[model samples]
Target: MKTHLTILLTLSSILTFSQNIKIPSDTMVVTTHTTTVKGANINYTASTGTQPVWDKKGIPIASLFYTYYERNNVKNRAERPLIISFNGGPGSASVWMHIAYTGPKVLNIDKEGYPVQPYGVKNNPNSILDIADIVYVNPVNTGYSRMIPNKEGELPKRETFFGINADIKYLAAWINTFVTRKSRWESPKYIIGESYGGTRVMGLANELQNNQWMYLNGVILVSPADYKLYNTSQPVYSALNLPYFTAAAWYQNALPKVLQEKDLLDILPESEQYAINTLMPALAKGGFISAEEKETVANKMAFYSGLSKKVILQNNLDVPTSFFWKELLRDKSGYTIGRLDSRYLGIDKREAGSSPDFNAELTSWMHSFTPAINFYIRTHLNFKTDIKYNMFGDVHPWDNRNNNTRDDLRQAMAQNPYLKVLVQSGYFDGATTYFGAKYTMWQIDPSGKMRERFSFKGYRSGHMMYLRQDDLVAANDDLRAFIKNSLSNGKPAKYEKD
Candidate 1:
């Protein structure tokens, strides 16, 4: 009887212990390395870790993975600035920005940005680490970050962190925890967001400031998805896409000889003017516009874009990217222009289709960046985990409810007078065209008194401009200058228009 009771008590204790083993709040692995940048030897510490994000009720909701790098031998961390970087996809991990562009190491790709054979990585001499300490954050459901699954292996509760505002909430929590943990509250903070992350940055500026009482020094928006300037329907959508259309056509040498010889900048303003003044009004009028006027508009659009006037008129003078990409180079070789980088071409079985079968540019780099990051994590950073790294996880049913971040950005600028903004765009990026970014920034700061605080730069590459070596150098130089000016409380230097 005594032996039986002892066995039952031991079994119960084991069950309780198994049930009480909670997920770890953080798992950190630190490594040190040295790299040469511009003939200067720099040593830095790379911290690969996961930080827990708890809910308002003190319940652990998600674990966010992050890579933090700080220059070694720095006497005062308080004087150093911290840049938190992320890529956008609503579901994307930070690997895109980490292994491909800004991080100390970049994928060894060709000059044209094609991944090299045997897939590897190399030191990025232009890495922004030379100036500021950077932390690449992978939000919940991205990279190794995930929601704690229940006993049934279902992630029902983690769905809340997948939305726009909820993402901001948890991300803010993680950043707060990191800053507090690292003891760098006095350091100037910056946010570097690419694509959808750009929208996140704007919301974060407001959320972090209002909720967490953390002030930011500057924001770097790369290929920003400014929904305020976005429209899905015809006319407005096409109008918004006009400059990009012109850019692609120019790149493919499909534009008329007169426009082809002209510099891209000269053509962009014309496209913007036509888009806002002519195309928008005509599209808004709908049936009210005369056929003659529509014919004239179509002819002008054809001249700027490579599409025929008949095709433009058939589409109601509104050529969405889907149709334009297929139609622009269709006559020459039956190939479709890439939506991300127009320089890339794709061969679709059905060339007559409205949209290309796939985005050639997006797929081209995935094979390289995906493997390179995985290799770097396990091999160089010495961070090992059984969980598969999710480069772009499926954060489905992502709620966009009340996600107007432009207002949040405006509010941040209004409240924080010293806060500056650097808006960058790749002229060849069909996603977030340069003119669209310019329009949004123009609308954001109309007074022009803050003009010194705002700088708009255009790159010669696609959405991920830094993938191009020259653009990476340019971007790095610009960022270094921006950081210097921001830390000194001086107005950011103006970027000469491209």
Candidate 2:
């Protein structure tokens, strides 16, 4: 398997076209201010501490640590825009975005996440700090950030790191201190989130507005998950059927002769329309129709999706993504394909039955860069610390599991009535279906008359669309334009139809 997963400049902050993790000693001169906030103890004061990377023995080491950075209206020849960024995993670090994508200086990448040696880091001219001063945070466990250990530096997995409410509360308090120190009460603040980070950002947006009586200027949700809990849980069998068939057809150039005649862009509308209007309705009516009728419908759907009618009938019109992997690439070697995107072929012909092709693009790379970056912060960024980086912390399950769409969305909208949401997705991103976002946008009040406030574009890649240079460049352009217009007029163009 020739893994194309070389250096992917996974979208966002503090990195670059760079190489090497061990960083040289440098002083950050990280500044701070002080204030009080309501916390578990109510004695939470805004203070800056040189977070040290502590050893298992609870000894402070000059490895990787975190402190605090604040400067409200950072007088950038004028008042600066305030922006806070974070990475998602329910337990990931914010360094990925803060250090790699938005900070003043960044690690390097060449359009892709490939390293530009001589320390794989550089001054990111593209850093949005020019317009929005950025604050990057590390959640409880993921980075060098850690908590008191129970036994032998080993933390409590259950009590501390296993749920969601605790996560948000701490994050809210952390932000309070962060903002108090910087005195950014006057600047227009914004939040940028990626992947699961989108969930965190939106959730945090609600918290910030509700608790602090503060509102953000805008929000940027990258590859958001509106309802993945239920969406991804769709009858896995049918869930697998559509996208797999679509990806297979795209890969084979076997789309309907008519769709193939036009460009892929032109064909997407019908494809998306079918998924929403036709396939969705059919699936919702599963078991309602007679077996014979179901078979007929499945076959017609198969032809429309470019799969063989026999294959459709075989799976009873609900061939899962896994089976599509085998069926589509069966002639080649019968290897199942990757889940993140079926374009990746596997070794086995049928279901893994036992194992699978590298579960996803993010798994390995996320594992790769995470520790390296932690080490980088300790040595290079030089804040000081002893906090564990909870790359994917246990969610405040209660808070998010029963998340309120109207309350959450309303709070966010009402807080930043002028909030502009810029969302982008890849058409092939079955992970966070592009249509789901479109649908969500349709549901939000601001989204209805705020079309100009929100903008979405689809590319031909998977969830991490930035892996492709063209898609990356196009997205960057759209973002730059969006940022520029947003600063000029805080209110987005009122929602309108495309």
lDDT of 2 by residue, 1-498 (tens): 011111112111121112422221111333222222111111111122223323345443222223333433333523456667676666666665554544443454445444444444444444444344556666655554444333353443433333444455456656765676567777767777776666666667777778767676677777666643434455422432364356446755666676667766666666666666666666666667567766766765765566677877665566655455445545545565455444444464344343354444455335445655655554544434344444554434433455543346556775454677777766555556565556656656653554556777776665555545466556655666666656634445243357
- CA lDDT, every model vs. true structure: 0.80, 0.53
The regions of model 2 sitting more than 4 angstroms off are 1-78, 98-125, 149-165, 228-261, 290-293, 303-307, 314-316, 322-327, 333-337, 341-355, 367-375, 383-400, 446-452, 488-498
**Candidate 2, run of 10 with poorest lDDT:** 37-46
lDDT of 1 by residue, 337-433 (tens): 7777787888898877788999988888786888898888887887776677888887888877776687788888778876889988888888778
The true-versus-predicted C-alpha distance at residue 309 of model 2, in Å, is 3.6
- For candidate 1, give the lDDT of residue 217: 90
- Model 1 clashing-pair count: 0
| lDDT, residue 245, candidate 2 | 54
Worst 10 residues of 1 by lDDT: 1-10
Quote model 2's TM-score. 0.71
TM-scores of the candidates in the order shown? 0.91, 0.71
Listed per candidate, the RMSD to the true structure in angstroms reads 7.7, 10.8
**Best prediction by TM-score:** 1
